[model samples]
Target: MTLFAVDIGGTKIAAGRVTEQGDLDGPVLTTTTPATQGPEAVLDAVAALVRQLDDRGVTAAGVSSAGVIDSSTGTVLGSTTSISGWAGTPLSHHLSQAIGCPVFALGDGHAFALGEAVYGAARSATSLLVLAVGTGVGGSYVRDRKTLTGSHWAGGHFGHLAVPQAEGLLCDCGKVGHLEAIGSGPGMLRWYYRHGGDPRLLDARELFTTADADVTAAHAIDMGAAAVGTAAGGLVNAFDPDVVVIAGGLSQAGPRWEQPLRASFTRTLIPALSGTPLIISETDAWLVLRGAAFYAQTRKDIA
Candidate 1:
């Protein structure tokens, strides 16, 4: 089946046509997310973009959004300051109404996992754990090709998992000591700044670029990787996933990040769980779009 897929992020909203064969039918389209203008404006922008891709052949639309989503109801149950007034938005209902098609909605983390499971690196695995470490560390667990969205649809929020390394740091959710406070890209930058890194460096990329020679940068990277690894190891012990896939911006940090994360993960895991493979996602650009399409296709019966 052909379906429309939308990825609504804080920075941009992307859309494209998806095929049942796990690929895009055409070029992906994008627009700036009207996050500051509130939910209605964001929805309008998304609907407009989807309409641009609309053809009689498109059967439905699937949306992957950033928030603690209630997939069953296609609602945003919680959100961060990245998008103002985003929580409590009835995403599926509104988008479906405006786009004149059935819409399925879920959090970005879940979408990433689903996409990987169906078409990316973990396609061969029966159970998978996905960690997307970017603006914040988002994650999801997919078993037997199905995402495990919790009762509140907040499942796989790995960033919020508390870690000793992040103790005393404030998280975006107003909570203290969450993994996002130390394990995310921004979190690593904050660590660099607080621990005597160059004050002029504003981007985490710059810090990571110089980690080979900069002590502070290396330390920050190691700390962040360790925190994430520790958390991931704990999660593995709890769930015993067949594989753990890492995605998002930080995954591109090369060996500086991956090495330490792998070290910490291996150290933290029990002997039985040590064999679990933790790898980076093989797919990019179209990951979420394909997952969104699959979500809509599979969950069409949601009331």
Candidate 2:
């Protein structure tokens, strides 16, 4: 059965079709998320996207969403402020009502790891982990092709880990010295500003432009990478997974960002786990959407 995969982030909504064999079909359809209009409008937006699909042979639909999701009931337990009024929304119920198909949902992190295992970088690996560092940090670990949602559905929140001991680094989750406070796009930007790296710098792009020569930009990037790498290292020690996938906006910033990440990740991993493949995801909008579809293919609750 073909699966309709929907990826709902704070800024965008993307949809794609996943064939039974796990290949993504056609270009992903895209639109801006109506996050500001409140949760109902966001649900309507997703339903509208599903309505445009060729549903004749579709058997199920899945969602990768930007929140802590209760996967069993397909409800969003909580979300970042980016998605206004999204908390406590029954996602699967609403989508099932709209599409008339088995609807499944999971936090975006798990979907990303599932996508990697089935259709992306980590294909052929029995166990893997994925970290998506973007506006904020999110990730999931998959073993035996099953994504772990955790008892509290907070399994993949690697960004909130206080692995790094940096001072004054506050995460959006209202914590101090979190991975997100240093590893995400905004985190790097916040670091740049806090370190007095020319207050006029607007964002991550501008900071990276001169990172080669600018001490502050270079320092911020390395610090962020170190936090991410350190956190990843800790996870590797804990899970002993075979592969790790790194995706998200900062990953696209090229080696200026990645060199440090790789270096720090290397520094953190133990000897036996050192060879675990570190993959840089081709994490475009399509792949992120495909992650959702990939998860639905195996999620027993929906099947």
Candidate 3:
């Protein structure tokens, strides 16, 4: 069941051979994505990585990419500008042709969700939501060891959900009041900046370090927590899932982040959904990378 798995991000392209026992088989190969260089260059980088394992006996490849992916067709329907010339690219076909194997492509959020379902926080839960709150917010739903990608391959993108209570924030998608606009890492940083916080504190690491002492910084974090809690409430009502795992960069805020998120989530939930499990997974992208490998090897179409 060893397969070549690649995680393609705006900044880096990571690839490795995945073992049958749910682990990477050897040292991971890493390189810059050359994202702005165009889709052709991105494909070139990936093809080069696949060629790195000539004798690995791998028969399949899986890609976890940052975008709204059409998994079945291996197409990038839409993507952040982080990777220029990426949208509409035939990612799956190009890789499959170059590597001489079936290639499965999945959104990074779904990859993370599936990976967590099989190996991390939601391993014991049949149906769970994996919510990642980072520079951007994305989500995925896993049920019975499979991910629901929806009709358009946009199933797990939950960041654009609107939060009626939140105000005066704009999402990159040009929507005001969306959860991403209010809850993502940059959103929180923006919150702090717009509220007259000291300009010296730039990222979450800095703001969180001064959380106890800086009123604005603390408020920004709490605001992000409240937004997630509110969005989770809506998500649960729609999906009716009992398990939700939160993972991403902001999850590293520790107790300061968890306590508020828990309180708000609890208060927002209806009586029937009380005490539903909300787990925080480790803040690591490797989990999603594993999921990509797992999917490439396990998907019936690919096999």
State TM-scores per candidate: 0.97, 0.94, 0.95
- What's the CA error at residue 7 for candidate 1, in Å? 0.7
Model 2 quality (TM-score): 0.94
- On lDDT, the stronger of 1 and 3 is 1
> For residues 57-104, could you state the per-residue lDDT of candidate 2 as single tens digits?
788888989888898899999776889989899999999899888888
Q: lDDT (CA) for every model shown?
A: 0.89, 0.83, 0.84
The root-mean-square deviation over C-alpha atoms between each candidate and the true structure, in angstroms, is: 1.3, 1.8, 1.5
Give the clashing residue pairs of candidate 2, or none.
none
Cα lDDT, model 3, residue 171: 84
Stretches of candidate 3 exceeding 4 Å from the true structure: 300-303
The global Cα lDDT (0 to 1) of model 2 is 0.83
lDDT of 3 by residue, 254-290 (tens): 9988888888888878888876888888665688878
- Residues 76-134, candidate 1: write the lDDT tens digits: 99885778999989999999999988999988889888998999988999998999898
Query: Which runs in model 2 stand beyond 4 Å of their true positions?
Result: 300-302
* Colliding residue pairs in candidate 3: none
